[model samples]
Target: NKRVNHKRVYRLMKQLKLKAIIRRKTKRYKPFTPEVTAQNILNRSFNETKKNKKWLTDVTEFKLKNGNKVYLSAIYDLGSKTILSYELSSSNNNQLVFNTLDKAVKKVKNTKGIIFHSDRGFQYTSRSFKAKLKEHKMIQSMSRVGCCIDNGPMESVWGMMKSEIYKGNKNFSFINYELALIELAKYIHFYNTNRITLKMAKSIA
Candidate 1:
């Protein structure tokens, strides 16, 4: 239909422009003011002292409405600001967290002395989790009980996923969760390759 009527395309574009102009002139939409504040941890210390010296992991739970919940655990490589691995499951347990960690470890060539940082959540403090880190020759690190800055990057990613992609949607099934995961993968690809980071200004040249 668009191909058959070239003038129709121009008319639609004009209508869209008029609508946009009217909306802007009328001030119908208000700017968003963020109520929740995230601390700036990476101020000038964003660079990792060594590769894999600090890795961040975070867990976010989404309710499935029938009272079931899906837990998502992710491991992020702080050095590269990249998501190394993530796992989604109906249960928030050691198994899910371990699977995420193992998948991340598999991607790295050397696992020795990697610092895995997370909140003092039970999943991260469990004996099973500690044992796995020891087995992989990685060190365990934890943030203070109430500090979000300690794991800011991971939390930021989760916030973006929840607000931008899954806003107003709740009680998702496995299939819906899979679709969100695929969308997140696409967003992450755009973030890493197409979106320029302010920190990379000097390096880009």
Candidate 2:
């Protein structure tokens, strides 16, 4: 048996153009038509002194093995940088966002004064979702049109999650939609329990 350096093997693979093939997921959701647009109350202030005072929500899509997409809607607490609740669905509809919000409200002790921020996506701007916020007596905030940086923290969560769990991982291409959901659930648990951050020096859990 002969030994070959891993670097040389990688170089050879690169030279042979034998890199992995990963399909880029495209955004297929309908264009957002704002029924109601809230002001940028969050104002790029990604910090909250008290828990449940400020929260962020967003949806990110994942492509499964069967060429179908699944959306993950999550609510993140700015104070603790914790994911309060999340819902996975095959459709990125208003119900998905509303269900995620419902879950978060149930888990939290107080929701009357929480300022929930999100992009001006159709799901967030829908009249029904606005009514849901009002029903909880929560304040709604929207990121400025076409400016994602206004909701930078929530975007960071999606970026970090995909990089760690889905990107460059060949296993995802073979996993069925149901298993992908399960895997995402497990990853969310690990993220809240084991992942450490410099801001808190502790897991978000």
Candidate 3:
């Protein structure tokens, strides 16, 4: 293992014009088609007093060992910076977003005028989803096109989740779908009940 020192190896590689290659995983499916675009009502105002006053939702994709993908749809409470609900599925379809929305609505106490924020993904823009929001009397807010900063809070949640649970985990890629599900479930529980954030100065739960 000590055949070559790290500094010497770096110098040799530089001399040979060699560099480490980082392979990125590519999406297996086509990107979602946009149906409707909503204004960024959130406007990066991530603070809220009431727990259910403002919520954010988004879907993230993860690759499995067999080249298949899994999608996680989550609802985050802006007030507490807590995960209200989440759904994992093999497909990132309209149903995935619907299910997650339904779960979060049920878990929360009230939602008469809650502002539900998200990016303009196809699932969120679909007529069915808009109807669902109207049915619950929830206001739908979306990030402006090509403006990731509008959904910064939700994006931060996903980033921290991945960093804590998957990144640097050597065997993560070798795990099967079911195991991946279990791992995520456990982490979500810990995140909601135990993990602390400086903003809250306490655990979200």
**CA lDDT for candidate 1:** 0.70
TM-score per candidate, chains pooled: 0.65, 0.81, 0.83
Instruction: Tell me how many clashing residue pairs each candidate has.
Output: 0, 0, 0
- Error (Å) of candidate 1 at residue 18 is 30
In model 2, what is the error at residue 32, expressed in angstroms? 4.4
Against the reference, the lDDT scores of all candidates come to 0.70, 0.87, 0.86
| Candidate 2 Cα errors over 4 Å, as ranges | 1-32, 167-174, 202-205
Model 3, residue 28: distance off in Å is 9.6
Off by over 4 Å in 3: 1-33, 169-171, 200-205
Clashing pairs in 2: none
- Across 65-109, the per-residue lDDT of candidate 2 in tens digits comes to 788889899999988778889999989888898889888888876
Worst 10 residues of 1 by lDDT: 35-44
Cand. 1 TM to true fold: 0.65
Residues 77-106 of candidate 3: C-alpha lDDT, one tens digit per residue: 988778999999999899999999999989
- Indicate the residue-level lDDT of 52 in model 1: 71
lDDT of 3: 0.86
Instruction: Report the C-alpha lDDT of model 1 over 130-149, residue by residue, as the tens digit.
Output: 77888988877776656777
